[model samples]
Target: MTTLTQLEWRTMADDHRYLIRDMALGDTTISETVLHPDQSTKGHAHPWPEVYLCNAGEGTLYLDHDGGHPLVAGARYVIPGGVHHRVSTVKGVTFTCVFEGPRR
Candidate 1:
């Protein structure tokens, strides 16, 4: 068992612009991501579906070609496998992303 307090947060890279804490359980991976204002993630796709649970602040979830969906605290969004998607924040945001497969 693991707790948030036990997880160590780390930045991916200078260009990524976000902090993350990842935990692996069996075949699933749970990651906590924190994005500051004006920060965004690069659009990408996964081999399996991804689930995001908003924990704080506000943001937008951008889908391929389509526009974007508002992201608010306490809301959840699911992105299907192979679908391009990304996230951006205006007032900063923290969310938990759960992957259906092993941690990559």
Candidate 2:
């Protein structure tokens, strides 16, 4: 979908301020997540490498407990799996993450 409203967004898990929707085809999965203001995705990791596109807003992407980079709109990032990572937003952020295999 080209717009946020065009996608079937839904509350993700029990994480407050987090919303997500999934689109899967074949062996790939793409998930769109919106993080509200003053919230974070919490430090977590997956078993497979993935990529993320900063769809909107601004945020910081920290990996492996080290310094992070600014996540500006229109930016893309590739994060290897098994590495600790987290996203913290200021005025909220919307990002689309792509990974191989089905959504777990």
Candidate 3:
């Protein structure tokens, strides 16, 4: 039981692409990522599965083979391990990403 507001957020990626707050809970790691307008993350793959919950704004989620998907506030997406994915936003977005793996 942890309060998100109590955690410290750190900047990540080139040009402050995103702000993240990470918390480790037993075997799982939960991260909050905030992306401002016109920001994007480079496509990459992870070794463990990841789940994303959109908390605000609209965006685009790029998945390998699946192309891009609409990412609106209140949406959720589950990505399999080793699947390449990236996120881009046009109007700023905040996402809660959960995974049962080590934090990068």
User: How many residue pairs clash in each candidate at the backbone level?
Assistant: 0, 0, 0
lDDT of 2 by residue, 1-104 (tens): 35545545344454677888777655777888888999998678888998989999999999998889888899898999898888999899999988998766
Q: What is the TM-score of each candidate against the true structure?
A: 0.83, 0.83, 0.83
Order by lDDT, highest first: 2, 3, 1
The root-mean-square deviation over C-alpha atoms between each candidate and the true structure, in angstroms, is: 2.4, 3.3, 2.3
**Candidate 3 to truth, TM:** 0.83
lDDT of 3 at 72: 86
Please write out the lDDT profile of model 1 over residues 1-104, one tens digit for every residue. 77757765544434357887777666777888888889998778877899989999999998785789888999898899888988999888888888976555
lDDT of each: 0.81, 0.83, 0.82
Which pairs clash (backbone N, Cα, C closer than 3 Å) in model 2? Answer: none
Better lDDT candidate (1, 3): 3
Cα lDDT of model 3 by residue, 77-101, tens digit: 9999999999999889888889996
Query: Where is model 2 more than 4 Å wrong at Cα?
Result: 1-11
Error of 3 at 85 (Å): 0.4
